[model samples]
Target: MNAKTPDTPIVIIGAGPAGMAAALALHTVGHTPILLERYREARPAGNILNLWPPPIKALQEMGVDTDDLGAPCHTTFRGVKGNIRADVQIPDDVVKAYGGGFIGLLRPELYRRMLAAMPEGVLRPDVEVTAIEDLGPTVRVSLRDGSSIDAAAVVGADGIDSMVRRLLWGPSERREHKLHIIGGYTFADVPGVERNEVVLRHDRTVQGTYSSIRDNGRDGIQWWVLEAWNPKAEPPADLKSHALSLARRFPGPLAALVDSTDQKHFQRWPIRDRKPLKRWSKGRITLAGDAAHATSPYAAYGAGMSIGDGYTLAQELTGVDLTDAAAVVAALGRYDDRRIAHTTAQVQQAYVLGKVFHHAPAPLRPVRDFILDKTPMLQKQVGEKSPAEIVAQLDEMGAGLVRA
Candidate 1:
């Protein structure tokens, strides 16, 4: 096949946050990208979410209006007794620039903002990509409709069961954390709820937490309760009641938040993630978001990291000639080098946290709690290390998507 032209466009599969961000970032960097979503429209898979500073910066750089996007929250890890175990201290300048240490909001609002900023005709819905072939200078993507298109590159932003990832790297087992989370949001006035704060509390076994959220100028709170669950077992028949029961274990307005939540707002997810791959790109094709690194919610940065992936990918691909196989390979290799180590650390950390918090032995429960309460280990790990990483990412992202 002849070398593809620059106008051939980079094809991005999936329309989730990662895919949409990729399309926006790629467009910002002067690349023509086609975003394909199997579904009729781009939709959020869950409701409640939080984003750190790095993603906020990425959104702004991609031309998405970050003003009043979400509730700015000062997050703290606390015990059931309300004693703060660790305070996530993001730099004041970062908090000011990005809105807060962590921005809490409903997932759908993020989708709406990203979708609004998406270039017209960039996203093609109801188009299912069935196969991908890296043909030296270009990639040919076959659709379920028995049609095909050639692209300069293919980015798989598809979710956990990513077909692109499977094609690049062989299938790997989904490592089930054997944990479940029941989450919901409420716009009603809940008494005793803290404003603009993320109160994450843990009791003996269950983790009940709530964060302030703002949706289209309406202020509210989003909460979730996570516990060890049998992966093979059926979900609770009454999710609200079960969440309420767990919420009651924590001292605060968590239960009130749950009670105020409507039935329609409730959501549940069984936590699972694939092992991080050592490499994310091969030839003219690469991976992004959950396709590259499926993460447990314990990281709270899954979506944030996915947004960062698109931002970073665009930066690496800028000024590179896509028609040249060597140039494409080199650019994708740089993407892998920049993303792999950081994502792998986050994935492993989230997995270990699930094991430590919910799956610890009964006899070690008190010991674990005592250590967490008495020592600065959690403080150093989450409060310090996490912020440092976020700052580092922001630095690495530089001034904008396109290099000066």
Candidate 2:
């Protein structure tokens, strides 16, 4: 077997959550990793966000500060009339262990914390990876500036339109969910808003939801409305007005929260993701995060899963000899085996949920709502099963980032 140079670093393309986490975790595992970003600085793509406990634990183990990172929320699915449809029942022990079951925080704050924990000189901004090739013993990453770096392994942590993914597994069409979400956050002390809770409500055709958020020691709330929309159509002229109109459909402080949000804090996103790839690694290169499995936000675990990917990748490569082609391939195969199934399940579930909630037939709307309201189907699927799956990762993570 060809041997790689020990001094060659593992190169990660993209400085998003996945790339950054991978670099940190790799460092924890005693590997030098170079994180490259195409942008001038690392930034989050969206504002409103939530994260499950697995990712939280992963972040903390990687040395990112977890003290009051976000508001701890008891999330529940509700009908538009304020009746609880399904309660997310995360175990109390898990909640206590991770600081919260599902955390509510601004995406930028998360970026800030992760970036703060990042080691200096690891992240190279403004250096775009234009091409990647596996050369048996080493992988070569060509930059936009005509320079190239050779590494023992390369991780494609780039976003949905990942160049490494395209190079490794050809191009695949994006799967549009035909839905859009308008969301925003506010620090205003809006009356009638519940604290420390995520109230996700759905009407016949729209989903209006809000959750408590804590940003930098300040208590606040974040809200969003999701509905079917044509991907090609122009966005609403007035985003706040449109969001407020949707908020009005659901009872309680959703509308007021929307009204209280500053125009600068509001944002909109069209939901889309690519189909899950059957394989993510080939030779000395592998994929992570959206590059491996682009998922819709309906899962609310996209970023969480991305962080988990980095942590898991680091674990799989902990003591493996990166120089040995067989060992590197075996390590990557383990990473794929561990990540693909879980992330793919999430991607498919989120896609199906979007279709069911927003794109369902008009005639079947009442039938679906009635089932969700009366039956334990949703509770079984989302409330119990989903939490079980998420919490299981904590155990699977096996103590910490560094293997014993």
Candidate 3:
């Protein structure tokens, strides 16, 4: 076998979906990569994540079975506000193009499943990375424990606030948004909301999502509220009150979900984003997933994009002359080139949706709701304006890996 770095393993930063998926893909290509995570272990957090179809094929290639991950189906989206409520039907063609539907699994369970797929001793927890230096032939990664190691290549899958991204592009190069989200899950399910549907509640200034998440043999309600505010503003000391304030605009079920949430389970996340970079690699160090391009949850493709990155990147590197430093750099470059456009579109779509959905003026709300109710445009907006093009990219990635 042709080893890219004969003496050193390719070091993968972060053990999240993207990093672990990268490890899985690299292993498929006969390369062993060590995963470093800042956390001690995968703990349960966040609500259900909709893993769309684009990345499901890549996940299957990496030995992940989407069937057992969660309920793989489309949850009907019911728009609610005041006395007005309407069901938003996604176009059948769009759903069919996406390869059936999505898996609305709990985020932590997905994390655990991906973690368990890795071979033993591949992941190191509680190892915080401090710095990374591109030393031409090898990349040097420094840890918080006053230790460092050299690798033939370094993959930055550390996520949105990626230290690797900061190291590579510096802090000034990154871009973020003002949309702040505070969310939590309740141990009890909300009445009136069906098991296979998600209710979207919105007012003039805020929106919330309510759905059911199954864990530990019982179903619980998982919900989130999005509101735009100053990034520098301090989060409210009374989280419950803050959450209610956002949910006040929403009607019964959403408010009830928030009220049922325990204080311990409440979490606030400042939704941040980064535009696609012209270049995601320099020498042997490069980035994948959120580390390279973090999108708003409006796109709902962040996890899928990151998971697909590992699959596609590994596919591009397979059969290449890894021993040749120049060839390795070129392979990394090709990975970036193939991903930039698609992920950029994802970022842009999410950004625009975030702006329009949460902050649209009162007068424009009618138009927005009318379009969502009467046309298939909303389906395209949530699913990509060019569904065929996105499907083609996903197909190419899957086909390329099969060839690998």
Model 1's TM-score against the true structure: 0.98
Runs with alpha carbons beyond 4 Å of true place in candidate 2: 1-5
Ten-residue stretch with the least lDDT total in model 2: 1-10
- Worst lDDT window (10 residues) for model 1? 1-10
Q: Which stretches of candidate 1 lie over 4 Å from their true place?
A: 1-3
- Model 3 lDDT tens row, 284-373: 988988888888877667888898899988887787655568988999999988888888988888888777777678789888877766
Question: What is the Å distance of residue 241 in model 2 from its true position?
Answer: 0.8
Model 3 lDDT on a 0 to 1 scale: 0.73
**By how many angstroms RMSD does model 1 differ from the true structure?**
1.5
Question: What is each predicted model's overall lDDT from 0 to 1?
Answer: 0.91, 0.91, 0.73
**Residue 158 error for model 1, in Å?**
0.6
lDDT of 2 at 301: 96
TM-score versus the correct structure, for each prediction = 0.98, 0.98, 0.85
What does candidate 1's lDDT look like per residue over 1-404, in tens digits?
Answer: 23456588999999998999999999999899999999999989999999988899999999998899999999888888999899988888888888875889999999999999998999999999988998876899999989887899999999999999999998989989999999999999988999999899988899999989999999999999999999999999999999998888877788988998999999999999999999999989999999988899889999999999999999999988777789889999999999999989999999998998999999999999999999999999988897688678888888888732
lDDT of 2 at 14: 95
Residue 341 error for model 1, in Å? Answer: 0.9
Give the poorly placed runs of model 3, Cα more than 4 Å off: 1-7, 42-48, 73-100, 144-147, 216-218, 361-379, 383-393, 400-404
